[model samples]
Target: MARKMLIDGEVAAVADGGHYDYDLFVIGAGSGGVRGSRTAASFGAKVAICELPFHPISSEWLGGHGGTCVIRGCVPKKILVYGASFRGEFEDSKNFGWEINGDINFNWKTLLENKTKEIVRLNGVYQRILTSAGVTMIEGAGSLVDAHTVEVSQPDGSKQRYTAKHILIATGSRAQRVNIPGKDLAITSDEALSLEELPKRAVILGGGYIAVEFASIWRGMGAEVDLFYRRDLPLRFVINFRESLLLLIL
Candidate 1:
């Protein structure tokens, strides 16, 4: 059944809301889902968003609010980068004729604890935002049961079904660990951010942004880093050619 939606100088077929519990049902409470639900709710649409329960460590059943960017991706990575850069600063100060006498060391536990606290705080903030926007936030993993119905599996093994006029999927991404021998011994960037001890030797095996960033981070913090990529040039496609050339020259 084709339905009509009013758009910019156009009418398009939209979801038919003959019998829906909500006008909008979002699958994930990541940045996109939260924003979309909030916007729809502000426009007087009945919106409900579902997500996994909050935890410092993420898994299939324990994804927190704020999604990848807020929890495991950008926020935590940048915090680690900032903490790691201090070693570079201390080293560079010697060139500037500053006499520093103390033995500097990095505390992985301290940084991890602080980062966890900050992410927890941000999660609460996102929850409050959803509440203020009048969006019903459900805690669970949502899947499409039908075109207009979502089935959520909660952490406690309970399930709930919601029918909506339109459903949104914004469950965000996860780190893909490469398959190899002894793969369990290796950690992805997500785990790297929360390591209990800084590694003395590290080998990163990718040319992507995350790989290179982790390489730089560990190297800056006094780790022996060997980055391996299939291509002769690292970050070849991602970095601007001229900028990469300049960096290599330098």
Candidate 2:
């Protein structure tokens, strides 16, 4: 006999009502999954969210909380940019009657360590948020076995099956590299955020916002940056090449 229940303002039929584990099972703990699960739980639905182990550099088996935008995408990138921007600030302060003495050197190790500490702290904060929301947080990868069944694989290769009336998939997206020769030697944005040392020279590919942002970041930190783009104009033709004003003239 099929059992029916109301979920998210909709009626859903289940094969076994008494045997089901949760009302809502969410895959991926990224922003979407977290928001969806929290919302569902707020509506009095039993929710369980699954995600991989915490890692700054993500892969199929390891992804931290808060997904790409919070973890590797925006948060870390902005931190680096802010750290690099200090160079301009220090130089500008000299013109404002602030006497600057000695060579102003940026320490890559110190910045990387502090950024990592902040990220790890935020990861714990996200977990606490889920705990407070009453959502079950399972550390693993989730896959759909059926319309109402989800299979979660833990880090130790063990798996658990949970049946829910509704399931949400929000694993998020991964960065793709250009299929060129020696592509493996190139690093993606994820690795760029946690680099141990700043490179003296950097050649960035693409003409998008990310590429331009990184070029500015490195250039601000005193690196020789060369950006390559296929389009006639950089940044989708919104900003001209010469008048882009990447270099900070202090």
195 in model 2: Cα distance from truth in Å?
1.1
What are the lDDT scores of the predictions, listed in order?
A: 0.82, 0.84
Model 1, position 153: C-alpha lDDT score: 95
Root-mean-square deviation of candidate 2: 3.7
Taking all chains together, each candidate's TM-score versus the true structure is: 0.87, 0.90
Leading candidate by TM-score: 2
Predict model 1's lDDT versus the native. Answer: 0.82
Model 2 score (lDDT): 0.84
* Local accuracy of candidate 2 as per-residue lDDT tens digits, 1-250: 0122343333344555354577788999888888888887776677889999988999889898889988898888899889889989998998899998887777999988988888888888888898999999998889999988999997688998988877889999888889999999999898888888898999998988899889989999999999999976567756655345444331
Q: Supply candidate 1's per-residue lDDT for 114.
A: 92
- The per-residue C-alpha lDDT of model 2 at residue 162 equals 88
> Candidate 1 has which clashing residue pairs, if any?
none
Identify the leading candidate in terms of lDDT: 2
TM-score of 2: 0.90
